[model samples]
Target: MYQLNLARSLAAGSVFGQNAVKCSQMLVSEGKLEPESFNIAIGVAAKMRGQANLRAFHEHYLEKTSEFRANKVVRRFQEAIDSLSIGSLGNILVEARTTRIRPTTRSTGLDEGVRL
Candidate 1:
């Protein structure tokens, strides 16, 4: 799946419309769209800060998933849209990048496991 923020960072918001359209058209049939891809496209709409794209995303996802799942998606999608619209995404992105990643560790009964 194409990363929505990648277009926002690498190109411009204008490009996101084309990406979202293409993604939606590719999954025109029901049962083709998955949660991850639907989420990303909706996120692109939010991050692009376009009302049309958001509507398109809403319609497209509704076609792909159930009402129950759609409700959950819509709630989270609204949150993302609100975050972007209100300019909180900048701080969120910075916070995300600045957060420290914990090292991964594997345990062995012999106490010879390594950390990475």
Candidate 2:
């Protein structure tokens, strides 16, 4: 469960997301992780990195598992793929960047001009 959560977190990251998905797949293949964990991680990767980025992973998983199509996450992902036009599929990064809200820094109680 810990590893699964870690994989999900990594899958949500922009830089290491693809590698995390690949590693999750490898772990499943090696019996180090559950198949469901791989599904969850891949689903997150597909959502965060976009379906285009994870297409190879999707294809490989589909080829390897008869149950791939039946998984709810994979089913929704397939639905999303089918419903979206090609152009919209490329907007995941743009959407992510545009929608993010940055936190504001809080002022310390000390004097404003004093160096810490």
How many clashes does each candidate structure show, in the order listed?
0, 0
Q: Tell me the tens digit of each residue's lDDT in model 1 across 11-115.
A: 444565565555444554444565554544545544665555666767777899987777777777767566552234433432455558988665657767554
What's model 1's lDDT at 36? 51
- Please tell me which predicted candidate would have the highest TM-score against the true structure: 1
lDDT of 2: 0.55
Query: Candidate 2, residues 68-108: lDDT per residue as tens digits?
Result: 55354566766766675433443442244645787866768
Clashing pairs in 2: none
lDDT score for residue 71 of model 1: 71
What lDDT does each candidate get?
0.55, 0.55
With candidate 2 superimposed using the best TM-score fit, by how many Å does residue 96's alpha carbon deviate from the native? 7.1
Deviation in angstroms for 12 in model 2? Answer: 22
